[model samples]
Target: MSEVPLPYRVTRVRPETADTVSVALAPAGEESLAPFMPGQFAMVYAFGVGEIPVSVSGIGDHELEHTVRSVGAVSAALCALRPGGRIGLRGPFGTGWELGRAAGRDLLVVAGGIGLAPLRPLVTAALAAPHAYGRLNLLVGARTPDDLPYAGQVHAWSASHGPPYCQVTVDRPAPAWRGRVGVVTTLLNGAAFAPGNTTAFVCGPEVMIRVTARELVHRGLAPHRIRVSLERNMRCATGHCGHCQLGGVLLCRDGPVIGWDRAESLLSAREL
Candidate 1:
């Protein structure tokens, strides 16, 4: 049963941007989906089409949400399914961002484009209990104002509490756009974290991961303390197929989240 797909009924479909949708699903049966920590993903099957790995964007009281961008055949079919429709789901798989390892220290979250999806649950976890960690900084980068997801929540998180702040930048901004415009690293200058005591979780395109990790290291955050999520290396949701390889790690089972010290060499090389 663990290897087979289970049914999940789509309960909500939220339009995050022009091309992106956040699909919320609930178990089709009485059994509840197993709980998942932030950074974990599930293999979603689109019935007639195929299956793809999607990260858990939000864990609601009765549902699990994944932010889907219709990038290809499988994803487009997944995103096209309406509420009340059913799709196949399996897993809350892979290693999560072990927050315990970063306990009592500053948490810096850097996300690019849809990469923010995987990190959303962690933001919720940290902000709900603000007393556990030091300063919490969320830095997000998007291609344009039109492409940014979590628009409403991003504003709310930055405004809510003093210690947790969210800074966003875009590669291109339209006229009258008010926020900063630059790569995500530009916001690093104003981020409040003592390099020695900060733990960073980064996710995005490999280039962005490489640049962001390099920036964090240049600022003195321990290379080992910087964690990154790799999507390029995760083709199959389970390691059984043996296709997803990021350097020596089998991303489906061993990673998708790896330490900067371990990922740096692989990321810089580009093709592995």
Candidate 2:
């Protein structure tokens, strides 16, 4: 394997949604950064605030962008950084959404709140290769309408991308809103899922994953067909620090994306 790149300088920052901002980084002495899989995350090191893991929100031929929300200390620091500020980056690590398996089958994506960050890459990758799958449905749930990530892009994708569907739900709706007003699961009630031939990618909080996984299984999806992206404290991307250990599995290495059956024991364990 090649050595990971070091810190890069922030070249530009753009806001995607109300609470989310996309940061563009330029590698030292270079105009571009390495390409990464859609769902991989980079270990970002913010000066004086320590390091944290953030998912890559978008990638271009020349710039690497990350869509981040102000949820914790590191994120808050990231939100406060000005353009031209320097920050360290380690990876593009972890297993990503299994795009190959999604080929020729219906693809259902369920994302909650900032969980949309990881899924955004998978969506972009799939859309770029339109014929790789059958019908594609994206059901997103946020705290409110303003909390939805990539709102404009989601609308555009729904409009021009085949029969692709995008539905958004919010726990609280604005007065002028016409979309669903409830948990994301509520939006799944009447939707059709071809479990036998479909694959589902779910990323969100633990509670959301639990509920979503149960519903998918109830809808006849095999345990192995449901892939989830899990989050935990990670000190190293290479599984050296032991911060992301879950039973015999080290989330940093074994997966951030894991099949339901493979995660059964870990997810069921009391302390994991």
Candidate 3:
């Protein structure tokens, strides 16, 4: 991973929602960093604006994709970029989903809002090698129908009538919305899995991760079998910055992805 960001040219930008855009990038020069795994992230620099850790939403040959939500200045700059726009990127940083460990076991993916971005590549890999794993299940939640990204693709996965039995729920519904409505955990009751032989990957708001992990454990899934992605306050991708520290763990290096067993107590403790 190069600490000095490499120039990446935006090849395409597709608006996913009112305030979010999916930007596809390719190396602007012969220098490419490294291949990014499913759960890893990159520090995207928007020139004079700043940089932020954004998980790789999609990975392809000599290309990278980021689903940026325009909630702050840096992210807004990324969202505003059009085709041919240039930005700086560094990494293939942090732990990945490590799907190999789950070989021959059922797979469960739970994502909330933008959290789906990080988990998308994992789902795609599982789908690509369906026979390598047992069953694939996906549960997603968003604030509203409009707030959900990858609406078309998600439904397409669900419509496949094969592995990755997908279900989506929303906190609130729009006038024409006709899907289930509630928190993401609500879909857990209907997800197909053999708790003992299943491995789950979850990402979202911390609260959603907590409740979802708890529910999975309650249904007999081992805490260690449940992995979660925590963004925290990762300013520096390297561990030197204490901004992303959670208890004894530095999310930037130690995680962004970690086992629920390691996170349960830390999350329950009150932060001073």
Measured by TM-score, how close is model 3 to the native structure? 0.98
Q: Is candidate 2 or candidate 3 better by lDDT?
A: 3
Model 2 stretches with alpha carbons more than 4 Å out: 1-5, 16-19, 31-34, 157-163
TM-score of each model, in listed order? 0.96, 0.91, 0.98
Q: Which stretches of model 1 miss by more than 4 angstroms?
A: 159-163, 233-236
Sequence-dependent TM-score of model 2: 0.91
What are the per-residue Cα lDDT tens digits for candidate 2 across 14-118? Answer: 776665787887785654445778777888888878888887877777567787888888887887767998888878788888778778988888999889888
- 1-272 per-residue lDDT for model 3 (tens digits): 55689999999999988998999999999989889999999999999999999999999987899999999999999999999999999898999999999999999999999999999999989989989999899999999999898989987876777577999899999999888999999998888899999999999999999999999999999999999999877777998879998898898898989999999998999881
Q: Which runs of model 3 end up more than 4 angstroms from their true locations? A: none
Better of 1 and 2 by TM-score: 1
- Residue-pair clashes per prediction, in order, are 0, 0, 0
> For candidate 1, lDDT tens digit of each residue in 5-97?
789999999988888899999999987668888888898889988888888999888899999999999889877879999998888888888
Worst 10 residues of 1 by lDDT: 232-241
Which window of 10 residues has the lowest lDDT sum in candidate 2? 155-164
- lDDT scores of the candidates, listed in order: 0.87, 0.80, 0.92
